[model samples]
Target: MDLHEPVTPFAVLDADKVATNVARLRGRLAGTGVPLRLHVKTAKSVEVALMAFDGTPGPIAVSTLAEAEAFAAAGFTDIVYAVGIAPDKLTRVADLRERGVDLVVLLDSVAQASAAAKAAVPALIEIDSDGHRAGLAPDDPAVLEIAGILPEVRGVLTHAGRSYYAYTPEEKHRVAADEVAHAVRVAERLRAAGYAAPVVSIGSTPSGHTPVELTGVTEARIGNFVFLDLVMAGLGVCAVEDLALSVVATVIGHQRDKGWILTDGGWMATSQDRSTAQQKIDQGYGLVTDLDGVPYPDLLMSAASQEHGVLSVRPGSAAELPDLPVGARVRILPNHACATAAQHDRYHVIGTGSRTVRAVWPRVRGW
Candidate 1:
């Protein structure tokens, strides 16, 4: 059976769109000369990771040790666990590094640095460029403190989470440039204090697609761009058509009076992340589209239950939509690709212009 008909609630990852998205970003960074590290935390699929690096061992950023191990088993050699290093995971981190995976741990505090130093694990200082999350300030004295304390220091890095909050192209560019400058400043501070050339890195999906001067950056780590979601689209980082990940579901019933279409794809299938609410447009749970991927006019997954989704027409756009009978198939574009993909086990890939499932990439979760 085709991917559209095989199941009522399954993830349909557009293989063609994913490849295109990565290639497009790669092309954008071709002139920069700085390497781009695909953050695997979003997809958590080794196959998608392979596509990011052209099927070879290369630089990647993972959120969990399990993801690092998963990619390491699939032939990925370089992995940076982006989250702060837990005092206990140093052993496993070192074990992965010892096994030929260039695992770089993250340290944000002197305590964390001391612990990693004691365990003989190399780490990067998570720079706080956006002020939205944890990290050492760009010029904070702790930069030198951490560097001096860690036995093996990898470099400096930042996520640029503020980029996601940008409301315009100009705002996005400003945030990206600031993040690059912060990483550069931190790297310079480390160097002045006698540390060798540090690996400077900064990234986010919003910044990845926006115009930014990435002069002093050594690497770019972006993940969500692989599967553009409604939030990304709302922020102008990508168009709705660029969304590669979608949930394919079948209509089971409807609330005729209220113009609601019910589907089996609910909170269990599509994650209930309301990220798009912060943007110009808010897709309830997700945006609804036809079986062929065309968006249904004024439609959204207005609400959801454990195993059910209520699709309804948005206000002020009351044009007659196509019939959605029981068992009729539809696709759902997610608001947050990272959260949505987490609910699925394997991606039923559909290549460009191809009807059959091209590949099934298993997703890794836990720890």
Candidate 2:
């Protein structure tokens, strides 16, 4: 089918670009000996995950239990439910484990540890490396406390959430190093305390791309690298051309007086994630591009309603608005790949530099 055959306001994924991205990261970590526990939260399709691991099921980290269950059904044996485990979710976790899946949960509290212990579920202690989100500090007494409560501690995990804001190369390297250091420290502490904490995991898209030495780290969990977005581009982690995912929307109308080209794709299509707002350049909603995925100079989705996207040239740019009339389709690059992709049910897959739709890959949705 033709790429434009699809109705406007749908997700389009470049298959070749996905392969290039997966290979690029795999190459980077090839010599490190620390395998990538590819996070399935971004591209929830089993096809994409298989592409990441070269057609074989490998270690994966999931943000939701539904993702865990979906991947488990796909024959993934080593899975990590990377979110903090809630006591009520133990039944579901246990069910997955009963299917011969080594599913590990993450937690930082003793109460959660107690519940996991009672359920005989393995768990990793979440370590806070940069104070970006929930996790115990490397030196926190709770690390050992939680380990003591759990029957068998799997290991330690930390995400460099702050690395997204590390715009410079030096800053990214530092954040990545710190992330591994913190996770290694906690794992060593657990081993010293007589707990067989074996796994040491640390990652974030930025950290994964940065040149950090993963000395004692066992694996790195990276999801967004599959579909590089404007946020990662803004952080210097990946170039705009490296982005593999985009929302295809058609031009419905225009406001000539204000130089606004309106599209049917709004915040709902691209997501209301103004993550680049904190960066040096604020991508209002998202960067607008032609169907070929070449971004027009200074063109961006300036404003968005539930179903309307207002496209205009960047404030101080000299580039003129392209002559996109009604019915002309355009692709809008996203700010956050995970959030934007969630707005769509499936991806209209295409090959590199091609306008034909190769396949339609469905996404695994819901909690």
Candidate 3:
């Protein structure tokens, strides 16, 4: 399909690549007896979630209550609201449950547990693992304290976001294994305290693809394996070809004097996330690709304005694009898939390895 025909700055999804990514991740977790509870926080579309779990039975994990409501209304019955719960959100969680949607939540404090007590939604205790994010440590007394406040609490969960920071295969492996250990240990701790902690969950796209032991873990809430970004590829968690998401941008003009290709896709479309800066390779805004998605490793979106993305050649590089005149359409591989997708409201899905538009999937944003 002609990318120029579609309105510029919209997200283009590769459905075939998405299918293969899900399959490849399932292949990695085969024989582990744990289900791939997909984190739909990245894809934010029921259409994409259906494709992500095409033939599998897995609950979708969301990062927001708005996402939970959207997916629930779309016939998704089981959703894991992955983010730590805000006390004020319990009413919304209960409303979803009234609609027969199993909206599981996460908690780390006695205050949240008390807020959830009457709401009665099942909750998972968040574990810090190595992420050092908003979670309690495996042995923190707060675990039992929170559990006691809400007897409906069912499990312990952790996301080793540190995997995104690892610089070596060994380090990534250690992070993944440590995450697994942390979740398992927390579950063991809770069970020993007579809490009946039946669920032990661990995930993070980078660590989920590593050589980690998932023994005794009940759920692997891995996301981003569906549509990997530069951060995942730069961390060696996934190959560049595995990326299923890109931005179809139109070359509005050229800055021949400065050797720059000006595009209509700017920070408004690609987002202002520069997570790759901390990685071994910092793809300025994103790497430029041809209309068909073939990557131009040497070309980068060097800078961006609200409505303009400046594409220029890489430093210390010899690759040249001296003939990409104005009005040319190119796809940009994003740095962070979730943040980039959030900038758009819909996705134009193309055939596997082909650029023709096959379908357009609407997405949800906000909250």
Candidate 4:
């Protein structure tokens, strides 16, 4: 069926673009002395992750155990549940281990570590690369103390989430260096303890694009580079031309009085994530664009309610062009690829036409 015919808003992942992104990242990480452990959290789909790996054995990282189990069953053996695992998840972790999958969990505290140790699987220490959220300081004895736990420690991993907060290329590059530094320091601590510490992973799409001095990192798990978004564009990670995925929305109304083009795509289709973390600039929802992925460069969606998105131009430009008629098809570049992908059940595989040639469903919401 023609993907655009459906009134329902859907996401599309271009097969050709996916392949291109994989190649681009592979070339960037060449000789970095670390394997790319593609984080599935951002991609979410087993199909998308498989495409990202492009016929390579991966130490796949997931945000949920359900994603881990789904990918594991699909023959992905080396999996790391990047999010913290609670006591209740131990049973699922044990089950995955029984299947011969090298399942790893994340822990930040001694109590969490002690709890995870009971699951009989090694746990990777999560380092707060930018201190945006949960993770222990790399030099904190707590990391070493957690690693010292026999058989339960699996070394360390970190996400330069702060890169998401960076407003300039220089700032993003700085955060990338800091990400590598955090990993190096923690890895050094691990060596001092006489542990092999095989997994010193670090990444963030924006930070990964810049030159990362991976001195002691053994793995880099990055996602979102697979589907560049407006936020990435704003941070100067990649230009809008590099964006591989977008939401196809049909213009259902035109408010010339207010200079708005109402599309079927709304907060439900795009997601509620503002992604604007008190930064110098905030992409309210996303950039307005043509069906072919051309950002109206001048147009932006400034406000949105559950099922409605309002479009606008900067104060002075609104009067230049006034109308986007009803029934017109358009695409929206999301601010956050991961959250945007989660709102839909499947990606309508777009190839040479407007029709959906196939459906790629991403694993959603669970352990």
For candidate 2, lDDT tens digit of each residue in 1-367? 9877898799999999999999999999997888999999999989999999989999999999999999999989999999999999999999999999999999999999999999999999999999899899899998988998997899999989889879788888888989988899889999999999999988798899887788999999999999999999898888999999999988999999999999999988999999899989999888998998889998999999999999999999999999999999999999999999999999999987889998999999998
TM-scores, all candidates, are: 0.97, 0.99, 0.97, 0.91
* Candidate 2 regions with alpha-carbon error over 4 angstroms: none
List, residue by residue over 172-290, the lDDT tens digit for candidate 3: 99998999898999899888888888888888898888867789798888889899999999998788888899998888998888989999999999999999998888899999988
Candidate 1 residue lDDT tens string, 226-318: 888899888887789989999988899988988888899999999889888777778899999886678988789889998899998876776
- Badly placed stretches (over 4 Å) of model 1 are none
Worst 10 residues of 4 by lDDT: 314-323
TM-score result, candidate 3:
0.97
Q: By TM-score, how accurate is candidate 2?
A: 0.99
**CA RMSD of all predictions:** 1.2, 0.8, 1.4, 2.3
For model 3, name the residue pairs that clash.
Answer: 1-356
Error of 4 at 275 (Å): 2.2
Off by over 4 Å in 3: 55-57
Q: Between 2 and 4, whose lDDT is larger? A: 2
Clashing residue pairs, backbone N/CA/C < 3 A, model 4: 65-367
TM-score of model 4 relative to the true fold? 0.91
lDDT of 4 by residue, 81-163 (tens): 88877868888898989989989888888877777777677888889877798898877878877776647557788888888
Winning model by TM-score: 2
